[model samples]
Target: MAGKIRVLDPDVVVKIAGGEVIERPASVVKELVENSLDAGARKITVEVEAGGRRLIRVSDDGCGMSQEDAVMAFQRHATSKIRTAEDLYRITTLGFRGEALPSIASVSHVELLTREHDSDVGTKVVVEGGVITQLSSVGCPAGTIVTVRNLFYNVPARLKFMRSPASEFNYITEMLIKFILAHTDVSFTLRHDGKDVLCYSSEATGGDLRSAVAVVWGSDTASELIPIELSTPKVRISGLTSKPSLTKSSRSHQVVILNGRFIKHQGIALAITHAYQKTILPNRHPVCVLRIDIDPQLVDVNVHPTKAEVKFANEAEIQRLVVEAIELALGRTIVVPTIALKPQPKPATVKALKRAEDAFGKLLRSKLQIGTEQTAQTDLTASKTHAVTSAENVVMVTTPETKPSEKHVGIGISGGELVDWHEILMSLHPVAQLHKTYILAEAPNGFCIISQHRAHERIIYESLCQKETRAKAVQWLVTPITLNVGQAEVNFVVEHLEAFSSVGFEIEHFGGGTLVVRSIPAIMVNQPYAQILRDIISELMLEQQMRTLEELIDALRASVACKSAIKAGEVLSIAEMEQLLSDLSKTEKPFICPHGQPVALTITDEELRRHFER
Candidate 1:
């Protein structure tokens, strides 16, 4: 038998390596954003159409490249940041690998327009599938504008794996947010399809991360963040942490950066979380932005192909530092204002007036009592009042009135009323509200309680979930919305077209890697379709290797529930609250939401009495 022959082409090797570099539009985004940062760009503007499938244009007012350098940038392993192996140890620039440009160009149709400040002329280069189709000198302003299109066009297999535009767009936004937090000195703008999604102006307060966070996340959440600064010989840690009251249900709000590079490290995240173990409720994550700056030699960024994960030389020490810093910061007392009670007037009586006069002596006491009496009549009976008096023995006399039915009445309990305990308590019929959030109704020995909002959420969540599963209705648009996507995303849509239809999305592929959305699911008609499609694609792509279609569909439904659920602090009327409580009582798992957060928490009358020392 003849020996088996094996041949490995260099082009095949290059293409395989390229796959690791350019995985999606977000990958391209990461490279471009890093490049802008490395070039010392103070302001970077990223504009994407069709979730960066049709076009991903990054314009930066950084030091642009020369004609020769622009042409060389497309070649594999070409970089200005590193030269020899030793240079890697002290690497500071974000795009040192030099593989980003060539890798991106190899997988997409790339157009580069760049000009240096010193040069009057600019260079324009166009590359498709690693082949340079055009290179010319042109007149242009100083800076760089990189436009990537037709991603994964040559690799049909890879193209088939791209996520929906909305999903991709979210990923892009997440990446942008990371960069914005990391570099507060650099102004960033993100525009999608001619509409601006985010705009951040550079802060004058010496690169405050809080300002950037306030711009991206709402100001309400950002306002609660407290500053943290710590330094040691090996590392420096600085950032902000949200107050305990502002914790979120998910870890999405936490932002961690290692040496100005955004990273996803479970160790560091767990360290911060462990520090806050008891202070924050279980399942609730604190909002934080932590930046750790250590010597470059101590970190190995090369460990991950995406460079989003790094290995630290002294992880234990780093963890200790992070934990200690967070713990110390949280231990400090925070002053929150309490409602002030209104002052009340003493009852006018000869004996009371004589006692007051004796306490304060004649002249001062008489004047104060006269002023108090004048203001007493203006105070409404229903208004809250606080009384200041030295006389300990006080009595109120009132005529007995007909008692209402014990089963129907609810009254507030007073401390002194316990003397005639049985008679007063039986007549009062005061019901306990759990956590001051729900009412507990008595029914002989065993009692049923009602959840105010959870009941409402459960009813709404189940009804929506059922509607989603039974018969999803499509809301057709009079005018179709067209979105440009990468060739890969187009392939993904084609592969999952039937699934999309099942979800009541009327989408058809337009020529040249574009999708025209004619209708959305009736449930999501008001939602941004581009964003919804992108989210669906991302969900599908993330679990493509691990889950079946049915599992993915379930995950999608959960996401919809999470998005549509009524948030906390929404005021409800008595009828609405009652309806919500009734619905919550009907749910199988009435105590918890789908995300595993407590829908309602109950504190019994016994527990309340213990707390109040009753």
Candidate 2:
């Protein structure tokens, strides 16, 4: 009889251990690059071919290892960073476990060339599938060079799970960015397929984080970044945070480099959010690059394999430190870019644009019953077009100041999709504004109530939808508005500028995470165009926000309508009320707004009787 679990072979054990550390080319790069930084490397170069499936070479100019040390490095649990068990509690170096080299070598063919500065010659060691195949003395530079080839060739299962070459390369690029941002003292050059993709020279700025941020995010964002510095007994925090105006839709732009390694802490994130609560909206996240130096004894880096996560002794205190530092930095500066719009010569086109804007809410002459009541008829037809504008829009509406005549109006949307709702809305006679928020109306059956804000939101939403074509009205900003939104949004905007153009926004990339807006949808021109751009980008960047290219234009329309819609507290004249209800009747979904909020609620005669117990 055999035991259910037999001891695995040496090769099997090494390969299995390697799987834990070397998941992809990015993982390989992460481990090797950290080793270079740990060796006090001043210059590091990473080269990849075929997204690291063919080869990955990481060369660093630092203190290299001797021939004996080069051979011993392939063995597991051998490390110069630590010696005893007690050292695990106070782990300071990035590569302390000493498993990175052995694990990487076990799953791939590796060649290491190293020479100390005082040594006349260097040693070359080659490893294949967890075995040292060759070791020889060679002449080389006074540094270390690690070349990995045919990664995961022995593990066909792992190779099958690899993503596309470009995707894998992107992952590698993203990982390198973290290392580059974490260590600004070292110069880094990354090449893919023999083309220089990114380069950073440490010769300039001498470890200025703002300069690094300028390289990664952009100079515009770096210029506006506020420096934060604070020292406590247990924690020292120093880094840069974006101004109140410069923020990202997501937290990916926020980075917390703990000690010398990048990490994520929920308490720290909440602290950042709390600090900027008064300045930014709840949904928006401020961009930050913070380095928190704390006593090693208080942190447990052994909690994760990759050391991307850490455990703090006093999380609340650390969070408080971060919050205070950021808040203090924010209080110290009040600088924002100001733009002076270039004056445009007012021509006949100006009047034409105004008239077009005014015509948005101006209803064409039509006969419809104001109410289903069989009482009387009054002449209230004199006031044809009256401005019923909100504080945010120049909407005009047609109403009666003279006489009333029989007029007609006419949605099948079961909320998600479309049904017939206009018949019921058309019959309701608006009585008066209740609390200046809702409109009370009378019906033949019982009565109806409408939320003025939601009703206008629906009206505006449909109007924007109707105008979502090349025929859209474009309001050109005299002086192009430039916005520093960040790398992710910049990539998105550049890739989908056509989507923006299709809906009437003429935006172009102005280099380095900055966008210049030449024009915007005429409907949203009066609103804060920059903020609108930010908000739209914010919403569109949300997970699953865009399903197809068509939805891109739809999102623009919806965002613009929501911003341009009338709100509560604005007093509406009778003409405005009638025009609003009349417009709502014409929409595809009159029962609910674009956001799915109820525009109007109706009580039938039966329901009213039941409520009153009549």
What tens digits encode model 2's per-residue C-alpha lDDT throughout 257-305?
9878988788889999999999997678998998999999999888877
What local lDDT score does residue 89 receive in model 1, on the 0 to 100 scale?
76
TM-score per candidate: 0.61, 0.72
Q: What is the lDDT of residue 241 in candidate 2?
A: 96
Worst lDDT window (10 residues) for model 2? 366-375
**Residue 323, candidate 2: alpha-carbon lDDT:** 91
| Per-residue lDDT over 509-547 for candidate 1, one digit per residue giving the tens place of the 0 to 100 score | 876446788765544443455555654554455444434
Candidate 1 stretches with Cα past 4 Å from truth are: 1-5, 203-206, 335-614
Score candidate 1 by lDDT.
0.66
